[model samples]
Target: MVHSRVSINIDSWKKVSKANKDQIFKEIHHDYAVEDNIKKPLLKKLGKMHRDWRNRLRSGF
Candidate 1:
Protein backbone atom coordinates (compact mmCIF):
# COMPACT_ATOMS: atom_id res chain seq x y z
CA MET A 1 0.00 0.00 0.00
CA VAL A 2 1.09 3.53 -0.75
CA HIS A 3 1.63 5.87 2.18
CA SER A 4 0.45 9.45 2.11
CA ARG A 5 2.89 12.30 2.08
CA VAL A 6 4.16 13.16 5.52
CA SER A 7 5.25 16.76 4.90
CA ILE A 8 4.44 19.57 2.55
CA ASN A 9 6.09 22.87 1.66
CA ILE A 10 5.18 25.39 4.32
CA ASP A 11 4.77 28.87 2.87
CA SER A 12 5.36 30.65 6.14
CA TRP A 13 6.71 29.95 9.60
CA LYS A 14 3.37 30.94 11.05
CA LYS A 15 1.71 28.39 8.82
CA VAL A 16 3.66 25.46 10.16
CA SER A 17 1.49 23.11 12.18
CA LYS A 18 1.59 23.16 15.97
CA ALA A 19 2.39 19.46 16.02
CA ASN A 20 5.50 20.02 13.93
CA LYS A 21 6.55 23.00 16.04
CA ASP A 22 6.05 21.02 19.22
CA GLN A 23 8.04 18.16 17.80
CA ILE A 24 11.02 20.48 17.40
CA PHE A 25 10.71 21.87 20.89
CA LYS A 26 10.37 18.37 22.30
CA GLU A 27 13.60 17.33 20.64
CA ILE A 28 15.41 20.32 22.05
CA HIS A 29 13.95 19.80 25.48
CA HIS A 30 14.87 16.15 25.39
CA ASP A 31 18.43 16.97 24.44
CA TYR A 32 19.01 19.56 27.12
CA ALA A 33 17.14 18.00 30.03
CA VAL A 34 15.66 14.58 29.49
CA GLU A 35 17.04 11.73 31.53
CA ASP A 36 18.34 8.57 29.91
CA ASN A 37 17.53 9.66 26.39
CA ILE A 38 20.11 8.47 23.87
CA LYS A 39 19.16 10.60 20.88
CA LYS A 40 20.92 13.85 21.75
CA PRO A 41 22.44 14.13 18.30
CA LEU A 42 18.99 14.50 16.87
CA LEU A 43 18.56 17.83 18.68
CA LYS A 44 21.06 19.57 16.48
CA LYS A 45 19.60 18.06 13.36
CA LEU A 46 16.08 19.03 14.33
CA GLY A 47 17.14 22.55 15.24
CA LYS A 48 18.86 23.00 11.92
CA MET A 49 15.81 21.72 10.12
CA HIS A 50 13.55 24.12 12.04
CA ARG A 51 15.82 27.06 11.37
CA ASP A 52 16.15 26.15 7.72
CA TRP A 53 12.43 25.81 7.41
CA ARG A 54 11.93 29.32 8.76
CA ASN A 55 14.66 30.64 6.53
CA ARG A 56 12.98 29.07 3.54
CA LEU A 57 9.79 30.91 4.47
CA ARG A 58 11.65 34.20 4.85
CA SER A 59 13.17 33.68 1.44
CA GLY A 60 9.65 33.56 0.00
CA PHE A 61 9.67 29.90 -0.92
Candidate 2:
Protein backbone atom coordinates (compact mmCIF):
# COMPACT_ATOMS: atom_id res chain seq x y z
CA MET A 1 0.00 0.00 0.00
CA VAL A 2 1.10 3.53 -0.80
CA HIS A 3 0.42 6.44 1.54
CA SER A 4 0.23 10.12 0.63
CA ARG A 5 0.83 13.02 2.98
CA VAL A 6 -0.82 16.44 2.77
CA SER A 7 0.49 19.52 4.53
CA ILE A 8 -1.18 22.89 5.13
CA ASN A 9 0.31 26.18 6.30
CA ILE A 10 -1.55 26.85 9.55
CA ASP A 11 0.68 29.81 10.39
CA SER A 12 -0.38 31.66 7.27
CA TRP A 13 -4.05 31.27 8.09
CA LYS A 14 -3.37 32.30 11.69
CA LYS A 15 -1.91 35.60 10.48
CA VAL A 16 -5.20 36.63 8.89
CA SER A 17 -7.77 38.36 11.08
CA LYS A 18 -10.93 36.53 12.10
CA ALA A 19 -13.13 38.62 9.82
CA ASN A 20 -10.77 38.19 6.90
CA LYS A 21 -10.57 34.48 7.55
CA ASP A 22 -14.34 34.21 7.54
CA GLN A 23 -14.48 36.12 4.26
CA ILE A 24 -11.81 33.92 2.76
CA PHE A 25 -13.62 30.79 3.90
CA LYS A 26 -16.91 32.04 2.50
CA GLU A 27 -15.27 32.81 -0.80
CA ILE A 28 -13.60 29.42 -0.93
CA HIS A 29 -16.75 27.57 0.09
CA HIS A 30 -18.92 29.23 -2.51
CA ASP A 31 -16.44 28.69 -5.33
CA TYR A 32 -15.50 25.21 -4.19
CA ALA A 33 -17.08 23.72 -7.28
CA VAL A 34 -17.08 25.37 -10.67
CA GLU A 35 -20.40 25.99 -12.39
CA ASP A 36 -19.05 24.53 -15.55
CA ASN A 37 -19.10 20.77 -15.73
CA ILE A 38 -15.53 20.68 -16.91
CA LYS A 39 -13.10 20.62 -14.01
CA LYS A 40 -9.73 22.32 -13.94
CA PRO A 41 -6.79 20.65 -12.26
CA LEU A 42 -4.09 22.47 -10.37
CA LEU A 43 -0.53 22.75 -11.63
CA LYS A 44 1.52 19.66 -10.91
CA LYS A 45 4.47 21.65 -9.50
CA LEU A 46 3.28 24.61 -7.35
CA GLY A 47 -0.09 22.82 -6.81
CA LYS A 48 -3.65 24.17 -6.71
CA MET A 49 -3.73 26.03 -3.41
CA HIS A 50 -0.61 28.06 -4.26
CA ARG A 51 -2.02 28.96 -7.67
CA ASP A 52 -5.25 30.13 -6.06
CA TRP A 53 -3.31 32.10 -3.48
CA ARG A 54 -1.29 33.91 -6.11
CA ASN A 55 -4.37 34.62 -8.22
CA ARG A 56 -6.22 36.13 -5.26
CA LEU A 57 -3.36 38.59 -4.64
CA ARG A 58 -2.89 39.52 -8.31
CA SER A 59 -5.22 40.50 -11.08
CA GLY A 60 -6.12 38.45 -14.17
CA PHE A 61 -6.54 34.89 -12.90
Candidate 3:
Protein backbone atom coordinates (compact mmCIF):
# COMPACT_ATOMS: atom_id res chain seq x y z
CA MET A 1 0.00 0.00 0.00
CA VAL A 2 1.19 3.45 -0.85
CA HIS A 3 1.01 5.80 2.10
CA SER A 4 0.71 9.47 1.36
CA ARG A 5 3.40 11.89 2.47
CA VAL A 6 0.90 13.88 4.49
CA SER A 7 1.96 14.81 7.96
CA ILE A 8 -0.61 13.62 10.48
CA ASN A 9 -0.74 15.37 13.83
CA ILE A 10 -0.38 13.11 16.81
CA ASP A 11 -3.60 14.53 18.20
CA SER A 12 -5.42 13.21 15.14
CA TRP A 13 -4.07 9.73 15.48
CA LYS A 14 -6.99 8.59 17.55
CA LYS A 15 -9.41 10.01 15.01
CA VAL A 16 -8.06 8.04 12.07
CA SER A 17 -9.51 4.70 10.99
CA LYS A 18 -8.21 1.44 12.44
CA ALA A 19 -6.59 0.51 9.11
CA ASN A 20 -4.77 3.80 8.97
CA LYS A 21 -3.68 3.44 12.57
CA ASP A 22 -2.41 -0.04 11.86
CA GLN A 23 -0.51 1.27 8.87
CA ILE A 24 1.04 3.95 11.05
CA PHE A 25 2.11 1.37 13.59
CA LYS A 26 3.54 -0.83 10.86
CA GLU A 27 5.53 2.03 9.42
CA ILE A 28 6.93 2.96 12.81
CA HIS A 29 7.76 -0.63 13.59
CA HIS A 30 9.44 -1.03 10.20
CA ASP A 31 11.73 1.86 10.92
CA TYR A 32 12.39 1.30 14.63
CA ALA A 33 11.75 -2.44 14.93
CA VAL A 34 10.80 -2.03 18.58
CA GLU A 35 7.20 -3.24 18.47
CA ASP A 36 8.21 -6.87 18.06
CA ASN A 37 6.77 -9.15 20.76
CA ILE A 38 4.83 -6.23 22.24
CA LYS A 39 1.05 -6.14 22.35
CA LYS A 40 -0.34 -3.47 20.05
CA PRO A 41 -1.41 -0.40 21.95
CA LEU A 42 -4.43 1.81 21.53
CA LEU A 43 -4.17 4.76 19.16
CA LYS A 44 -4.23 7.27 22.02
CA LYS A 45 -1.39 5.58 23.80
CA LEU A 46 0.51 5.22 20.53
CA GLY A 47 0.13 8.92 19.84
CA LYS A 48 1.34 9.84 23.28
CA MET A 49 4.36 7.59 22.95
CA HIS A 50 5.15 9.04 19.54
CA ARG A 51 4.77 12.57 20.87
CA ASP A 52 7.01 11.89 23.85
CA TRP A 53 9.62 10.27 21.64
CA ARG A 54 9.62 13.19 19.23
CA ASN A 55 9.94 15.62 22.14
CA ARG A 56 12.87 13.71 23.57
CA LEU A 57 14.62 13.67 20.20
CA ARG A 58 14.08 17.39 19.79
CA SER A 59 15.34 18.12 23.31
CA GLY A 60 18.49 16.12 22.75
CA PHE A 61 19.49 18.25 19.82
Candidate 4:
Protein backbone atom coordinates (compact mmCIF):
# COMPACT_ATOMS: atom_id res chain seq x y z
CA MET A 1 0.00 0.00 0.00
CA VAL A 2 1.18 3.49 -0.84
CA HIS A 3 1.07 6.16 1.87
CA SER A 4 0.95 9.90 1.51
CA ARG A 5 4.01 11.89 2.50
CA VAL A 6 2.00 14.68 4.02
CA SER A 7 -1.24 14.30 5.92
CA ILE A 8 -3.34 17.43 6.11
CA ASN A 9 -7.07 17.57 6.63
CA ILE A 10 -8.82 20.61 5.22
CA ASP A 11 -12.06 20.96 7.13
CA SER A 12 -12.21 24.67 6.28
CA TRP A 13 -9.80 25.59 3.57
CA LYS A 14 -10.72 29.25 3.71
CA LYS A 15 -9.84 29.34 7.40
CA VAL A 16 -6.42 27.81 6.87
CA SER A 17 -3.72 30.24 7.89
CA LYS A 18 -1.01 31.32 5.43
CA ALA A 19 1.60 29.72 7.67
CA ASN A 20 -0.19 26.38 7.54
CA LYS A 21 -0.48 26.55 3.79
CA ASP A 22 3.19 27.39 3.48
CA GLN A 23 4.01 24.44 5.72
CA ILE A 24 1.96 22.15 3.50
CA PHE A 25 3.76 23.41 0.37
CA LYS A 26 7.13 23.10 2.04
CA GLU A 27 6.46 19.54 3.18
CA ILE A 28 5.32 18.48 -0.29
CA HIS A 29 8.31 20.11 -1.92
CA HIS A 30 10.71 18.53 0.52
CA ASP A 31 9.09 15.12 0.18
CA TYR A 32 9.27 15.23 -3.63
CA ALA A 33 12.54 17.20 -3.89
CA VAL A 34 10.77 19.26 -6.53
CA GLU A 35 12.97 20.94 -9.10
CA ASP A 36 12.82 24.73 -9.22
CA ASN A 37 11.69 24.57 -12.84
CA ILE A 38 8.80 22.30 -11.94
CA LYS A 39 7.70 24.12 -8.80
CA LYS A 40 5.12 26.27 -10.58
CA PRO A 41 3.56 23.30 -12.32
CA LEU A 42 3.46 21.40 -9.05
CA LEU A 43 1.67 24.28 -7.38
CA LYS A 44 -0.81 24.50 -10.23
CA LYS A 45 -1.51 20.80 -9.97
CA LEU A 46 -2.00 21.09 -6.22
CA GLY A 47 -4.49 23.90 -6.77
CA LYS A 48 -6.44 21.78 -9.23
CA MET A 49 -6.48 18.89 -6.80
CA HIS A 50 -7.75 21.10 -4.00
CA ARG A 51 -10.43 22.57 -6.25
CA ASP A 52 -11.59 19.13 -7.32
CA TRP A 53 -11.77 17.92 -3.73
CA ARG A 54 -13.70 21.00 -2.66
CA ASN A 55 -16.13 20.60 -5.54
CA ARG A 56 -16.75 16.98 -4.73
CA LEU A 57 -17.41 17.76 -1.07
CA ARG A 58 -19.73 20.62 -1.97
CA SER A 59 -21.68 18.45 -4.42
CA GLY A 60 -22.02 15.66 -1.82
CA PHE A 61 -20.31 13.20 -4.10
- The most accurate candidate by TM-score is 4
Better of 3 and 4 by TM-score: 4
> All candidates' TM-scores?
0.41, 0.36, 0.35, 0.51
lDDT tens per residue, model 4, 1-38: 76344333443578679788777866776777767678
Candidate lDDT scores, in order, read 0.57, 0.51, 0.58, 0.69
- In model 2, residue pairs whose N, Cα or C atoms come closer than 3 Å (at least 3 residues apart or on different chains), thus clashing, are none
Q: Model 3 off-target regions past 4 Å?
A: 1-22, 25-41
lDDT of 3: 0.58
The positional error of residue 40 in candidate 1, measured at the CA in angstroms, is 2.1
Q: TM-score ranking from best to worst? A: 4, 1, 2, 3
TM-score of 4: 0.51
Q: After superposition, how far is residue 34 of candidate 1 from its true place, in Å?
A: 9.0
Candidates ranked by lDDT: 4, 3, 1, 2
- Cα error, residue 11 of model 4, in Å, equals 12
Residue clash pairs of candidate 4: none
State which candidate has the highest lDDT: 4
- Per residue, candidate 3 scores C-alpha lDDT tens digits across 1-61 of 7643333363365546988767765676565655534523443465566668778877995
Higher lDDT: candidate 3 or 4? 4
lDDT of 1 by residue, 24-61 (tens): 55655554675434444454455567678778978999
Go through the candidates in order and give the C-alpha RMSD of each one to the true structure: 11.1, 8.5, 12.9, 9.4
